[model samples]
Target: MTSSSKGSYTRLCIQVNLDKPLINTVKVGRLKQKVMYEGISFLCFYCGRLGHK
Candidate 1:
């Protein structure tokens, strides 16, 4: 957990399949956090494949 001026937060790393629908946010009880993709490359939204746009 990391603490800042606002509050403490936990960072999460989840592995997901590129073929499935992308998740935008995660909700736990009443707290919802936006999901951001990092270190992802060669993704084509048109076909949901890598390196063949």
Candidate 2:
């Protein structure tokens, strides 16, 4: 797969491994917005914000 697709897949895997209630509350659009606005590498489910690691 392409690097972009691979990155998305990895993000999905990380999200799945996190607590259900954390990710369930926020809509996908909000997550995208957080990423866009903050220009971060990933959206953190636990803290509900964009972060880089």
Candidate 3:
């Protein structure tokens, strides 16, 4: 795992592999910000663009 520093946000990179047909993989990551936001943005490596709850 590795992390890149951004001015306002931090980009996290993780690696994993899948074992089952239905399951893709398992990834653990975190995003830390000074203030709370209304929307959620997750650029998933497997599924791609994930937003909101």
Candidate 4:
């Protein structure tokens, strides 16, 4: 099997359209990033972004 390119991975972002009907076979994911200041970092569960929760 062949592997997909790394550029395609970041470009392929998923989003749900509320205006359309909900589909059963769809996949979902979360966006996240860690914030660091002077060697200190924070973590979050909801949405996973630092301090966004």
Q: TM-score ranking from best to worst?
A: 1, 2, 4, 3
Against the true structure, candidate 4 has what lDDT? Answer: 0.37
**Per-model TM values vs. the true structure:** 0.50, 0.22, 0.17, 0.21
Clashing pairs in 3: none
Question: Model 3 lDDT vs. the true structure?
Answer: 0.37
Q: By summed lDDT, which 10 consecutive residues of candidate 3 come out lowest?
A: 16-25
- Residue 23's lDDT within candidate 1 is 67
lDDT of 3 by residue, 2-48 (tens): 38743654444434242312223334366333422233355343443
Who is ahead in lDDT, 2 or 4? Answer: 2
Worst 10 residues of 1 by lDDT: 1-10
lDDT of 4 by residue, 1-53 (tens): 35763332322235534345333232436644332223214533333345432
Which 10 consecutive positions of candidate 2 have the poorest summed lDDT? 9-18
Please list the residue runs of candidate 4 whose C-alpha ends up more than 4 Å from where it truly belongs after superposition: 1-13, 26-53
Q: Please, what are the lDDT tens digits per residue for candidate 2 over residues 1-53? A: 66666333223224333333243433466463222223336756556554533
The number of clashing residue pairs in model 3 is: 0
Residue 5's lDDT in candidate 3: 47
lDDT tens digits, residue span 1-53, model 1: 44655644656788778787566678979989876666768766556567753
